[model samples]
Target: MQVLVCGGTGCTSSASHQLREALRREIKARGLSSRVRVFKTGCFGFCKLGPLVVVYPGQILYCRVGVPDVREMVERHFAGGKVVERLLYREPATGEKKLRLHDVHFFQAQQRVALRHCGLINPEDVTEYIACGGYFALADVLLHQTPAQVIETVKKSGLRGRGGGGFPTGKKWEMAAAAPGAEKYVVCNADEGDPGAFMDRSILEGDPHSVLEAMAIAGYAIGAAEGYIYVRAEYPIAVERLERAIRQAREQGLLGRRLFNTGFDFDIDLRLGAGAFVCGEETALLRSATGQRGEPRPRPPYPAQCGLWGKPTLLNNVETYANVPAIISRGADWFASMGTENSKGTKVFSLAGKIMNTGLIEVPMGTTLRTIVFNIGGGIPHGRKFKAVQTGGPSGGCIPEAGLDTPVDYDSLRRIGSMMGSGGLIVMDESDCMVDIAKFYLQFSQDESCGQCTPCRVGVKRMTEILERITEGKGEMSDLDELADLAREVKDASLCGLGQTAPNPVLSTLQYFRDEYEAHIRDKRCPAGVCRALLDYVIDEEKCVSCGLCAKNCVARAINGEKKGRPYFIDRQKCLKCGVCAAHCPQEAIYTA
Candidate 1:
């Protein structure tokens, strides 16, 4: 019997380390350490109820576990052979206990291919990874199949790169293989700098071996002997796990020298990025790996043709490499059968924002946004209406409620002015202002721009200024037209993918929620009551109880009237429009105009 504790970053922040230590102490104290082993593994995906603890061979899942609950788990579940019913994950609506991870609604629709070994195997244990068919693909590629055959299998799988841009994976490998160089390289872009994106980090923390195995396979396919994983310095846990996995793989003869006795030599080294968002781009990543300033160069020759010290290089994100092993093991047809016609297999999304079930989920490509937001995500929180769902982090666009029924695939999402980016899906409800959302993404892109190209460096900044003016109620009608023109200019003139797709949020929001922008600029009214500068807080005389709550809570001393008698009124000049009076009012008398 084994107990798996969530070792992902999210759970670690919630004191999951203490929980793991407590479980180990409990096992030792009860003298069940021999019979039952406690281990720390990667994310279980159900982050809403983390830190998650799962017991296997029984596959019993317990959610929201803490250090204090460790003794009961050991005493009842491990030693006595019974589940702790109070600790099990309960269905919100039905109020029933969900034993297995699959029984939970959040995981029911998800088909985890990239996240195959994530919650299952202990990432630090090489034996556990090997038992689950880890290194088998690399061995098969090196011994039986030729490099061409391996590339063909990937091409047939229809597996586009999961890193922001949906480039063909096999084509990228083939380009590097065909490039005239005896010394080529494979790079894993683990520099996931997108705000609110934890997909790459989760994969590295949970299934580090999969990446190592896949990188070895990539090296064999692309005629490269050495690979580099360019990870951000911010992801310390992922970096530690990756380093450990690499060392373990080398010791087991799965990485260095003749891997798996196949005489095909391949190994990987780690390259730490200095938390630059532009380093997420292929060319910028190549520059950073070479110990230079991380910036993107113009891509006529692309990374596959000329990359990593002027040698042929193949680059793919953490999630993309995570999918490689499953494709090689199960065959292309098996993987292709899961998703839509163009897009194959499952896509992992870090589901966040105003959704009830904000966690990590891997659903098939054809799964509609409605299914993701309403079913798997448990809809929006606080009984609010769904306004839009933002995909692709800062580089992607927002899909309004009208596009909810649209199937989530590469081509489908692209058609709606959004790309299947690193798979960061942030759900937005009615309370969120669309104009503010566009401004937020624009600000992120503007800040992350490498400042190499004139259009990207200047255009993104100008667009942000325009957005800020509009949000602050200082915008004119011409600002909308100016925004469209600037977005087009930035998209056309940018050097790399970072600047090229930066305009997506502005363009898509304008296309879908133009009325909101008009309302902000023309009428100077924030319909959602989000733009504090444009809104005025006033006391509703009819509903006011003359209680001292509003007056006490007001920082500006705006409310003044007889307490517990007549209705109170707010002085417009003294009111800071902070909404503290509105929030403090028990009778809901305060209104924003």
Candidate 2:
């Protein structure tokens, strides 16, 4: 029996290591060492139910397994060959315990492509990665296929860069291969700095070898002998694993000079980047990797043409590289047949915010937003209606509930004013204010801006000021016109993608939830009761217990109730409308309108 314990950052922080030790001790104490192997692996994607434990040959998955549960699981299941009923995942609606992995709702809609070897193989173990056909893609390219043939295969696979830009992966490889440079470079953009975005980080932690192998393959394809993984310094776990994988690959003859005994002297090195969102851009990343300020440079001399110290460079994000090995091994047609006409294969998403099953999920392109939010994500929590789903990080836009049926492809999302930005899908409930959401993202983009360009630096700052004024109930209707005008100017005049797409959240909110904006401006009322300046708090006299709890907790002395079991009155003038009264109201008397 093989027992895989989740070793990803999420599970690791949640005492997965302790559980692994407990399981090992229990197995050893029972003298079941020969039959059972307890080991640490990467993320299972179902992060909400971590640290995940999977038992095979049955592929039985256990969720939220604590250290105390390990011995019982071993004694009952591993030793007695019986399933632990309480540990099994009980369905939310049916309450039926699911013993198998595929039976769970969370894993059902997911089609693991880039994430295939993630939970199944121990990332630290080169042998485990090999067992799952890890280096075979690189070996196949090295031994049989020519550089041109490899590039053609990737192009034919219809795989796009999973980074913010959905550029054709094959076209990028071809450009770098054809670029006039004797000393070219392959760069893996692992600077995943998007808010609520962990697709790249999880991939790196889960399958470091997959990325290394793909980079080797890319280096072979692009006539480059050198590669660099520009990962963020914040991802210490991912960085540590990549370093280990590189060291192991070198020791085992997978990396370094004359790899695979083929005269091709290809190698890779890690460059730690200070967490800069702009560094996610290829040029900025290249600049940062070379110990320069992480700033986006003007294009035309693209990364493929003049990159990484005036040499040709092939840059692909971590998720994009994660797909390379599979494309090489499975053949292009297998992947091309999966998604829509334009978008081929699966996309990994970090499903977060207001969703019931908050975790990492991978769904094929063309899968409806409804499917992701409802079927796969288990819908919104607390029985609240989903207002909108935000994609593409801070630069990406929000898709309203009306567009829930829209396909999650590059073109489809772009048409709806959103981009598949590193696959961060933050679900918003009805209680969330769209105006506030746009302001938050705009603020983040402005703060993270390298300020190299005026449009992003000054234009976005102006737009943020307008949003702030509106949210604070100090705006006229003309402010909306100015906001739209500024959005267009910023999008057109901005230097790089960060600036160009900075207006996405604002534009999307205006497009979908214009009424919310209007209410703030015209009525001086926040429909979602989020904008404090536009919110009104009142006490429901009939339901008020007057226990003085709300009054006691109120920072503004808004509630006035001298005696218990009597109706408490709210002094609207004194009320900050902080919702402290509503939150502390024992009888739920205080209300916001």
Candidate 3:
């Protein structure tokens, strides 16, 4: 029997390494080493239940496993053939134990494609990748089909780039191939800088070989002999795994020079990025990859026409390339049949913020947001209502409850005033202030702005200042019109996508949650009580028991009350709006008005 342990970064941080070692020691102690094998694999997507462990023969999925639980798991499951019911996942609503991984609600609606081999195979082992038909697409293209035929197949598949901009992948390859240059380059953009997004990082960590194999296929199709993966240095796990996968593929004659003895010569090298959010853009990424400043230039001579030292280059992000092999091996019609007419394939998303199941998920392209949130995500935690889901990272916009039933495709999201930005779906609950949320995203965009352009550097800063004034209860009603007008200007005048999309949050919030903004500006109050400057702390006299904890903990010394007598009153002038008194109140007497 084989035991698979989640070795992804999330599970690894939760002591999955120690658990694996403990399981090994226990199995050896019980003389079951020959029968029971333990292997460290990739992420299982159910990150909330990690460190996850799965035993074969019955596919018993164990959740939140620690080193201490290894012995009981080994002895009960391996020795006595009894299942460990305590470690199995219990359905949140029904409280029924689910022995298999897919039996849980979190995994029910997911249709894994880009993440196909992830969590299933050992990434470091090339044979495992090959066993799953990893490089067969490249081989098939090399032996049977010509470059034109391959490009035609990809075009017919309706495969679009999954890295924010949904550009046609086949059209990109066809352009690179048709460009007037014999020396072309293929680049895999792995600079995943989106907040709360880990889809690319997880794919790289769990299935590094998939990316490598797909890159080789792209190289063959585009007539590119060299490739570079511009990944950020922040992802050390993904970097290390890619390094190992490249070395393994080279050693096995899968990466370097003639593959299947074809005349095509291709190889890939890694270029580490300095964590610049702008580098996610194609032109900016090419600049960084060529050892230049990571800033985007005007794109009339787009990357396809002249890129990377004036040679035609083909670039696609990690998730986009991960789907290439599947499309090539299993006909374009099969992939085309899955999603809507425009977007045909599955899209992987990182579910974060206020959701019960905070993990990785891949649903078909046209799957509604309501299905993703309620069916697969298991809805909001603590019975809180879902306020909105922010898609496409900071550059994307928020979709309110009224838009929850909208299908999540590139065109659908764009039509709703949002874009699919690298697949970051951050769910917000009622506690999240929409105005504050807009401010937070704008602030991130402003800070990460390359500052090479005037519109993004100065315009976004101005928009951010307006948001600051409104949130601080010092804003005028006319500032609302200024904010909207400035957002449009910055979006139109910005040089690159960073500046172009920086105002998305501001514009989208103004469209959907105008009342929240009005409350902050006109009423001088934070409806969600999230903006500290707009909050007025009050002591609930009925609940206050003179516990004195609030008074003792107040650093501002704003609370006034006798130790055992009347309830404490706050001096608004002296209060710093730190919320310390409210946090320390034992009876929950403190509230924000």
Candidate 4:
């Protein structure tokens, strides 16, 4: 019996280390150490009920298993063949114990491709990776296929780059290979800077070998002997795992010279980014990797033509590279069969916000937003109405509830004025104010803006100021028109993808929820009551029993009344609108308007 304990970052933070140790101790105590092999593996993706433990051969999944449960698991399940009923995942609605990961609704529709080996193998063990067919693609590419043939196969796969921009992967490799340069380089853009995004980080932590193998394949396809993985310094776990994987691959002759006896030499080096958002851009990343200031330069001298020390370079993000080995192993038709006509295969999304289940999910390209939210995500929490879903993070747009039935594909989302940006899906409930949401995204973009170009620097500032004014109820009718004009100007004049898509949230909100904006501007009233400056707190005299709860909870001494037997009144001037009085009122007398 092999017991696999989740060793992913999320589980690790929740004391999965202690659980692993307890399991080992229990196995030794019961004299089952020889029979039961306890090992630590990567994320199981059912993070809402982690730290998870799965016993192999039977695949009995146990959710929320702590250190105390180890002894029972070793004795009863491992020795007596009796499953732990209490630790198994119970369906929230059906009250059924979900034994396998696939049996759970959260993972029912998921098609794990880029995340293929993520929850299955022990990332630190190269032997486990090899056992799970890790470097077979690289071995096959090196021994049998030419560089041109490899590029042709990728082109046939219809695999567009998964890093925001939907550029063809094969064309990028072909350009770098055909470029007139003796020295070329392959770069893995792991500096994922988008908010609410951890897909790349999860992949790096869970299956570092997949990325290593993919990078080696990219090096071979693009005629590059050396590769650089530009990962952010903030992702310490991912960086550490990637470093360890690289060292292990080198020792095992998978990364160093003459890999797999094909004489196709390739090696990877880690480059730590200083947590700059602009460094996510291809040109800026190239500059940073070369020991220079991270900044974007003009294209046409694109990364394919001149990159990383002025030679041909091929750059692809972590998710895009994660798809490479699978495409080569499973064939292009297999991948292309999964998604829509244009967009092929599954896309991973970090599902966040008001959704009941907030975690990472990989669904097919054509999966509808309705299915993602209602079926897979288990709907919004607190019985609230679905308001909108924001995809693409800061660079993408908000999709309203009315568009829930729309199919989620690259072209469909783009057609609706939103792009499939690195797949950050933030669900919103009815309580979320559209104007406030727009302002929040604008603020994030402005703060993350590199200020390299005048358009992004100045245009985003003006746009943000207008949004702030609108949210604060100081906006005019003219500000709406000005916002649109500025958004277009920035999109046209910006140098890179960041500035170009900075106005997405503003434009999307305006397109979908114009009524909220009009209400804030015309009546000086925030429809959702989220803008504190536009709202006031008042006491409902009928509901107030003079319990003095509100009076006692008022920090500013704003509530004035006789202790327990008289009517309570609020001093408006003294009230700070902190909502403490409202929150603490036992009779629910206080209300905000």
Candidate 5:
């Protein structure tokens, strides 16, 4: 009987380490340590129900596990041969307890490819990784396959970059191979700076060897001897695991120097990013990796032809590299059979915001948004209606409910005014203000802009100021037209991808939720009551019970009435619209308009 505890960042933050130690202590005390071994593994992807614990032989999945339950788990399950009934995952819709990991709704829809070894193996142990067919792909590529043949297999696999651009991975390798240089470099862009996006970090934390092996295969294909993983310093867990995986791989001869006596040499090193969002862009990443300022340069002399000290280079993000080993081992046709013609193979996503099941998930490329949001995600929480899902981070667009049935491929999302950007799926409910949502993304884009060129630097700032005015109920009708025109101008004239895609959120929101913007501007009201400046807090006269709580609790002293004598009313002149009176009212009389 084996017990696995999630050592991923989310669960670690929630005291999963202590829980693991507690389990070990209980198992050791009962003399069951040899039979019931406790191991710390990577993320299980169900972040909402973490810290997750899984007991093998039955695959019993325990959700939201605490340290206090460790003794009971070991005593009842390990020693007594009984399952912990209360700790088992209960289906949200049916309330039926699921004993195994595969039985849960969150795991049923997910088809793990990039995340295959994530929760399954001990990441720091290369032997366990080998048990799961880890370095076999690298061995085959190095010993049996030629450089051109490897590139051909990847091309036939129909694998595109999982990063925002969705560029062809094999084609990138092909370009780097054909480029005239002996010192070409392969780069893994692990600088995941998107809000609520932990897909890359999770992969690094869970299966760092998969990336290391894939980089070696890519090196053979691209004729590069050295590679670099440009990861942010913020991901200390991932960094630590990666350091360990590299050390383990080198000691085993899987990385560094000659492999299988094939005489081909390749190795990998790490370059730490300073948390710049723009560095997710390939050119900016290369610049940062080369000890320069993390800013993007012009294209056409793209990274494939001229990169990393003017030598040929190949770059793909962490999720993209995570898929390479699978394609190589499973065969290209096997991968190409999964998704639509254009977008083949599964995509990993970090599901976040107003959803019932908030976690990391992977699904086939052409899966409908309805299936992801309702069936897999378990729909919106609090019985609220889902308004939109924001894909592709700050540069991605918002898709309304009408487009929920749209397939989530690169072309399909782009057709609906969004892109498959780094797979950050943020579901928004009806309570979210679209105008305010657009402003939020624009603010992020503006703040993260590298400020290299005038269009991105000036255009994003002006657009943000306009959005601020609109949300503050100070916008003119002509400001909408100006905003639209400015979005197009910035998109066309920007220097790099950061500047080019910065206007996506604004344009998408304006396309789908123009009514909300008009309401804020014309009626001087926030439709979702999210913008405090546009909100007016008023007490319903009928529900007022003459309670002094509203008046006494108001720090602004906006509510004017005698104690228990007359109904309290907010003075519009004095009311700061802080909603403190509304929160303090026992009658729940106060509401916003």
Candidate 6:
């Protein structure tokens, strides 16, 4: 029997490493060390109930596994030949235990193309990666195909940039290849700075070799001997794994000079960024990589035309490169057959927010928001009404419940005022105030702006100020029009994608939840009761038992109920709106509106 424990950063922080230690010790104690094997793999994608443990050949996937549970799992499941029914995932709706990985609703709809080897293989072991057909595509490209032929195969596969733009990967490679330069470069953009997005980081942590091979393959296609992976320094696990993978590739003669003795020389270099959100942009990334400030530069000469010290460059994100190996091996038709007509293949998304199952998911490109949120994400938690889902992070938009059924293609999302921005799907519940949500993203955007353009530097700041005033119940109706006008100006005049897509969340929320904005502007009431300045906390007259809990809990002494068996009263002027009374009320009488 083999035991696979989740070693991804998410699970590791949650004592998955301790659990692994306990499992090994337990296996030895049970005298099953010879028979049972243990290996720590990357994310299982079901991160909500982590750290997860999958026992094979039974394939009993146990969730919320602890260090204490390891002994019983080894002794009973391994030796006693019994299943640990308690740890199995219980279906959120049906309340039924699901033992296997595919049986869980969270993973049922996922296709796993880029993430094919993520949770299965040990990232540190090159042999394990090879066993599951890792670098076979690169070998095939080196031995059996020409660079043009390789580019053609990628073109036919319809592989778009998985990094925000969704540009055709083949076309970008071709431009770099055709550019007038003997000295060209291949770049893997791993500086993932999007809030709630972890697709690239997770891929690197799980399968770094896939990226190295893909980069080498790209170098060969684009006629470049060197490649650089610009990753964030914050991702220590990903960096360590990538460094190991690169060393292993070099030691095996997969990289460096004359790979497979085909006279093809390709190697990779790691460039670390200082966690600047603007550095995710190609030009800004190149600048940061070259030891300059992370800022966007004006584009007429795109990266393919002139990049990285004025040389032609082919830049693709980690997720984009991760797909290369699969496309080469599985044939373009197989990959292109799955998704929508234009948007072919699957997209890996970080499922977050109020959803029951918050993890990573890879659905077909045209999969609906409803399918991702409800079917695969196991719906909203606590029976709360689904309000909206914010995709593409701050650069993307808020898709309301009305647009839940809309297919998530590039055109479909674009038509609905959203883009597939690095696949960050943040689910919002009824309790989340759309106005505040807009404000939050706008603030992030304004802070992240590189100040290279007036539209982004001044315009985004002005828009944010307007949003802040609205949240504080000091906004006028005309401020809405002002916001819209400023958003368009900044979007049109910005120098890079960072400034261009910054106002998306604000624009999207304004379009979908206009009433929420009006509630703040006209009524001075936060309908979602989220904006603290506009909220009013009061004790319910009918529900309050006069237990004095509200009065006792109120640090401001705003709740006044001197006598017993009388309803507590909250002084509006003195009340701090801290919700201390509501949280401490035994009768659950206090309410916010």
- The Cα error of candidate 4 at residue 303, in Å, is 0.2
- RMSD each, Å: 1.6, 1.3, 1.0, 1.5, 1.0, 1.1
Model 4, span 1-593: residue lDDT tens:
78888888788888998999988888888888888888878777776678988888867889888888887887789999989899988877678888876778888888999988887888888999999888999999999999999999899888888889989898988998999977999999999988888889889989999999999999998788999999999888899899999999999999989999877899999999998888888999999998999888889798899999998999999999999999998898898898989888899888888887777789889899999988888898788999999988889999998889889888999988898988888999989998999888888888888888999999999999998898788999999999999999999999998899999999999999998999999999988878888888998888989988888988899899887677799998888878899889888888887
lDDT of 2 by residue, 24-126 (tens): 9889999999999998888898888888888998889888899888778988999999988887888776788998998898888889999998888889989
Error of 5 at 76 (Å): 1.0
lDDT of 6 by residue, 418-507 (tens): 989999999999999999999888889888888888999999999999999999999999999999999999999898998899999988
TM-score of each model, paired residue for residue: 0.97, 0.98, 0.99, 0.97, 0.99, 0.98
* Residue pair clashes in candidate 2: 392-421
- Rank by lDDT, highest first: 5, 3, 2, 6, 1, 4
Cα TM-score of candidate 2: 0.98
Model 5 C-alpha lDDT per residue in residues 1-593, reported as the tens digit of each score? 98999999999999999999999888899899789998889999999999999999988999999999988898899999999999998878789999999999889988999999988898879899999999899999988999999999999999999998888888888989999978999999999998989999999999999999999999999899999999999999999999999989989998888887788888899999999999998899999998999999888898999998888999999998999989999999999999999999999999999999999999999999999999999999898888999999898999999999999999999998999999999999989999999999989989999999999999999999999999888999999999999999999999988889999999999999999989989999898989999998988888998878988888887888877677778888888888888888888999997
Model 6 residue runs over 4 Å out of place are 563-565
lDDT of 1 by residue, 469-489 (tens): 999999999999999999999
Model 1 residue 553 CA deviation in Å: 3.6
lDDT of 3 at 441: 94
What overall lDDT, based on C-alpha atoms, would model 5 receive against the true structure?
Answer: 0.92
Off by over 4 Å in 1: none
Query: What is the C-alpha local distance difference test score of each model?
Result: 0.90, 0.92, 0.92, 0.89, 0.92, 0.91
Q: Please give the TM-score that candidate 5 achieves against the real structure.
A: 0.99
